[model samples]
Target: LKFVCFNNDGIDEHMVWLIGLKNIFARQLPNMPKEYIVRLVMDRTHKSVMIVRHNHVVGGITYRPYLSQKFGEIAFCAITADEQVKGYGTRLMNHLKQHARDVDGLTHFLTYADNNAVGYFIKQGFTKEIYLDKDRWQGYIKDYDGGILMECKMDPKLPYTD
Candidate 1:
């Protein structure tokens, strides 16, 4: 698998990648232009973005700054349908966690994902925080069976790398 990394600067390409991610993240189209997202991804203070591969575009992640300032939330992460369960998802998670820790100096990471992904995050060292009803979800809740929140402390002692 190819691990491609890019930010919002590449508007068209990023939007195309986001479209493919819709299903996995259960997010609705915002109607905002790609430039808006590019701005967020380009923001030096509050956010970051990473695309998994240039060709496959198998997965990508968006992280937003958290209350702690040094930490961030895994706002959105997705692996294409066909690429699921082939280790791309796990690799993507590892990459983002490392990025948040090593590159950004963030110690905590969080996510709210469908049940299908809860175990995956758990396996990656995240601990479940709570389970939220489908109604509480803001986007694409109807598309998923259920939702769960998880968090983990990013420490160098962990085997994962940036």
Candidate 2:
């Protein structure tokens, strides 16, 4: 797996992931800009972006740094449609969490997930903090679906060893 910054040449890869994200929001949102995908990809810091693949990108995730927070936000995470639910997401998340713990001074990682993803996040030990009952995400979220904000703590609680 290689961590790559967004290059204009990566449009195709970004589009593939963006479509998946938009599809998740389609039920409540409308008219997603294809350019937004490119913008988000390009705007991310090089070190914070990662693509996992042996040869070509099979999956990818982005970490956007946020203020008043130590851990960056897990912005976009996608595994190819054909590769979903096959443990790629879990592997990607584990890598992301470790990167935050070992490299970045991250104590917590956060994201807004949809109905289908809540269970996945929970299985990863992420707990729900609050549910935005309505479309609090406005242009970003779909009106028909509620948005769940979840967080995973990164501070490892280990037994004290004298």
Candidate 3:
């Protein structure tokens, strides 16, 4: 699968891609309202890193980077149920982290993982012991009702894709 990242550079130009990404995320998150997924995917501040194969979007992570804050918040992360366990999730996340670091100048990632996702985030190097100063991300991100906050500090030396 090829990794593709999209932002709201020119909404009109990338509408088709954004739509497909939205649909894939929606399917993966059947419990989440489709409208909510649409809002996040289309938000101007958010960027989506997707895994596409045979010209079809298979998985993606939608995140919003707070550049001045030196971090990015993961809004949505998922792989098609059929595509899980094949390592696409890892590749997708590595691409997102690299893109955030190189293009957005972000050095950390924060995510609110519900019970079901906590283990996955842990495997991706996220820790509940948030090292980021509370003052930086406290009021910036929306609090999720039943989600546990996790943080991942980007390592500058490692090539994540490897």
Candidate 4:
């Protein structure tokens, strides 16, 4: 597997891969509307990193940095259903974390993790927190279910960075 930044060359294949994973995505992210998820992936404003196998996107992550706030928010991440449990997710996340740290100088990382993903985030050294930042999340907080905010400090000692 190879990791690549999202670019015009691979966006179409990535979109197709995401569509194929829609069912799994719905199960993992029940609170997020499908349209919103697609929008996040297609939006050029956000940065994305993709894992490709045989020239097809099999896993990836999307994130946005709030540099002034010293934090980066992970918008979405997933591995193709067939690709799960092979450590690809961990590899992708580590890449994202390093990108955030080295490129953005972000000291913290935050993400709204689905219930099924909470444990994974915890294992990555994130701590759970009730996300009540209405100003930033707005109605999303109310719409979200079984999802909670998880955060990690970008310390070298953390498992996520190692």
Candidate 5:
């Protein structure tokens, strides 16, 4: 079991993992549009950190880095229904946090979580109190009705993956 970060660079290994992640998201997130998930997963500007266990993609987090703005906006995050409550979600998120901070030098992470996912995000250290500047993320993030926007500030001192 490992975490793979794909930036749509067309690498053969990452592409395979991306396909698995797309399928998982489509299956796990019944309320999200499949077409939307596919588009973002394949988009070059966006990136995904996939959890591949036993060579199968059990989960992933899709995000866009705004390094200059110091935050990476999380577009989609999900784990397979069968994999839920098994700690894969936390590890996937921790890996993403490590990538956002170590690889991209991002200082914060943000996401719009639906009601069902608020609890999960909260457990992952995200808060509804967005300390981010409005101008930095105002037009950058898309609004979804009934979704609550949350933010998580990265602590440079912590090894998030640990």
Candidate 6:
């Protein structure tokens, strides 16, 4: 699998890749509201890293930095259902960790892990955290009951690798 940093200038290409993976979120993350997903896709504040196989987009991750560039949140990440459990997610996440560290100079990464994805995030070095900044979420996160807030502190000495 190959990964590409999304080019902001290529809106059409970004939409094509995003549309291709729309079903994965719709089906896998049913609890997540559709409006939120659409907003994430339409918003330019976020940056994305896409996974490609044979020149076709297979998966991707979208994220954005907080007011403080040292911190950021992963808005969405998904691989085709057929491709799950094959270490693709790990590779994507590792790429994200590296990008966050090298390009953004970020020290921490945060995200809301759905029920089914909690364990996966844990395995990827994220730990549960109490991030109570409702303003930061734009009221998108009401209660932490449905999902878990996870954070990964990047260690400069350790390399993120699959």
Give the whole-model CA lDDT for all candidates, comma-separated. Answer: 0.58, 0.55, 0.87, 0.68, 0.90, 0.74
| Ten residues in sequence with the least summed lDDT for candidate 4 | 134-143
lDDT of 4 at 76: 79
For candidate 1, the 10 contiguous residues with the lowest summed lDDT are 136-145
Q: What value does the lDDT take at residue 85 in candidate 5?
A: 94
**lDDT, candidate 1, 1-162, per-residue tens:** 445444445578655654455433443323324555454445544343444455435567767654345556665666666666787767777777766676667777656665666777888888886333333333422232245767677776575744
Task: Give the C-alpha miss distance for residue 54 in model 6, angstroms.
Answer: 2.3
Q: Encode model 2's per-residue lDDT on 14-101: one tens digit a residue.
A: 5554444434333222333446544555563423334546645566665564433455566556666776778767766776776666
| TM-scores for all predictions | 0.63, 0.64, 0.93, 0.74, 0.96, 0.81
On residues 1-162, what C-alpha lDDT tens digit does candidate 4 reach at each position? 677654223566656654544444555566778888767666655677777777676777777677666676788777777778888888888887777777777777778788788888887778886343435444332244566878777775444444
Evaluation by lDDT, superior candidate among 4 and 5? 5
Model 5 gets an lDDT of: 0.90
Sort by lDDT, top down from the best: 5, 3, 6, 4, 1, 2
Error of 4 at 97 (Å): 0.8
Off by over 4 Å in 2: 1-32, 45-51, 130-146, 157-162
- Given candidate 2, what's the lDDT at residue 21? 43
TM-score, predicted candidate 6 vs. hidden true structure: 0.81
TM-score for predicted model 4 compared with the true structure: 0.74
Give the number of the best model, judged by lDDT. 5
Q: Write the per-residue lDDT of candidate 5 for residues 1-162, one digit (tens) a residue.
A: 888887888788888889889998898878889999999999998999998888888899999998788899898899988889988899989999999899999999989898899999999999999998899889887888778999999899799876
What digit string (tens of lDDT, one per residue) describes model 3 on residues 45-141?
9999988788787889999999899899999899888889888888888898889998899899999887798988898999999999999999999
